[model samples]
Target: MAQTHTVTIPHFVTEASVELTHLTAAYAMYGTPHIQPDGRSNILLVEHALTGDHQVDQWWGPEIVGPEGVFRTDQYCVLSINTLGGCMGTTGPGSIAPDGQAYGSRFPALTIRDLVHFEAAVLDELGIREVAAVIGGSMGGAKALEWTLLYPQRVRAALVLAVSARASAWQIGIQKAQMTAITRDPHYLNGDYYHTEHTPQQGLAAARKIAHLTYRGELEMDERFGTDAQTGENPLGPTLADSGRFAVESYLDHQASKLVERFDAGSYMILTEALNRHDIGRGRGGLNKALASSTVPTFICGVDTDILYPYHQQEHLARNLGNLIGMAKITSPCGHDAFLTETRQLVQIMHRFITRIST
Candidate 1:
């Protein structure tokens, strides 16, 4: 297990000018330190996707970053920080406010840039002047892109997978529906149900179910389940209420229940909202202009079957970015979550990029 470290940011202000005193950022480091004399580590900063923490190997599996994995510990120092709005050990909605209450609904709005800024502060505290590479997928990918733009001199290279330069209306609409599923639950109590006996577990589960559909590919789902009834249960009965669920439904329910046990509802909402607001071009002219301005070498990859963030988005990023090395494609049956599911392909692409950057 990776040990957690924290840095205090006194009087931190958000992009919206929301003031937070004594802000804390929790991070975890892996790999052996290869620090230079100038206070910088040969570090590769790995940002996590939504609902992910700093436990990269634990969450993403050892094959992605283990000793013999693509991100070999002996090769480079790896660090991952929980996003500002995350729940795991990080100061988020679950954290206590100055008034001795959980921030919950009162947690300030967070933009993707705010997350980048918070991590940058933590990096400064760690005496890391620059990172060899900053890599991520999904929301993580957005942050990786932002790091290159926000501190072009600091990020030597970036590997962004399964994300776009801006959050699309289609993506926002899906997220809005998910948020609605949570807020509509009475137990949510306007995001202040922390002290209550019951949290919005049902709503959270439903939201997860909806999100899972988007995360996986239709072909994969069909091949896996294909309207088949769950074992020992009949799909058809006298009425729909009396009928047992299909195998796919059971799988989604399991996924939802798993998340509900570990994740806080308020944190989920806050993070999803932050992800919805992920626009790299915002306040920086436009998407093309913002991307074209970056001199940092970039590797943009996308899953071919991804419905949420399709291959075209990566193509656009590759075409617009000034220093794009190449646009790689991960051909997988999984959809948006292929970055996580297809580890072998991801490892290959990442290894290639790391090798190229090192050379």
Candidate 2:
């Protein structure tokens, strides 16, 4: 088990100018921290995706974080913070407000940069001036890239796998569809369903289903399901009005149900909005200006079969990053989540990346 830690933010004003106070950040540390006399060590910040928490080993698997893993806790002090506006131990919509009620829908709009700022705050409390590297995938990948631009001096290397420089219209449309699924649910109650009999289960589930569709890919679905009906359910024999579910539909339902059981719907919306608003160049000018200005050595990796955040998106990043090490490819049929699934392959690529940059 990893050691857990918490840091308090006395006060903060977001980029959007929303004021907050007494916020708490929940995080976990792996391996023995080697804080030097100057109060800094070899810190490797391992970030999590939208629905992930601070427990890196559990969700990411041994191929990523463990005694013999590529991260090598023996080599660097690994830190993983539960996302700020997340349903995990970190403070978010369900956290208590000054009035002692849940923040609920009143949770301030948080940006990807804000997430990096909060991570910086936590490092400040720990007296760490810099980190050896920042690594993550999906939303986590976005945070890793943000760290380089937002706090370049503090990060030595950034590894952003399976992410875009900014939110694309296609990505936003998919997110919007999920947002609609939850907000339009009769039980949503404008995101104030806590302690109420009415819960937005259906809506949240619908949102997850929509998201799962994007998380996977066309080839994956076709190969795995391919018009086959789920066991014991006959879509062909059933009446048209209440047809049985297809194998793919059943798969999506499973994914939705799992998320609903563990994650808060309010948090889902907030984080989705954050992803929708992600842009490295938001205030720095534009994509070209932002990527060109940052001198951080950013390494990008992409899954060839990922349709949600296609290989083209990463190709664009490689061509544009100001100080790119190079681009690595993880060939898998697992779609966008392949970055998480193909840990061994990722470890090999990263191993090479570190070696090349070292020489």
lDDT of each: 0.89, 0.86
Lowest summed lDDT across 10 adjacent residues in model 2 is found at 350-359
**Could you estimate the TM-score for every candidate?**
0.97, 0.96
Among all candidates shown, the one with the greatest TM-score: 1
Clash statistics: count for each candidate: 0, 0
Candidate 2, residue 280: Cα displacement in angstroms equals 0.9
Clash-forming residue pairs, model 1: none
lDDT of 2 by residue, 1-359 (tens): 57678889787777799888998999898876776776446778989998888999987777667778777777767899998889788888888889888887788888898888988988887778888788888999999999999888888888889999999999999998999999999888888777578779889999999888787767767999999999988777647877887888898899999999999888999889999999988888999788888788889999999877889989988888899997899988778988877777888987876665445
Model 2 clash number: 0
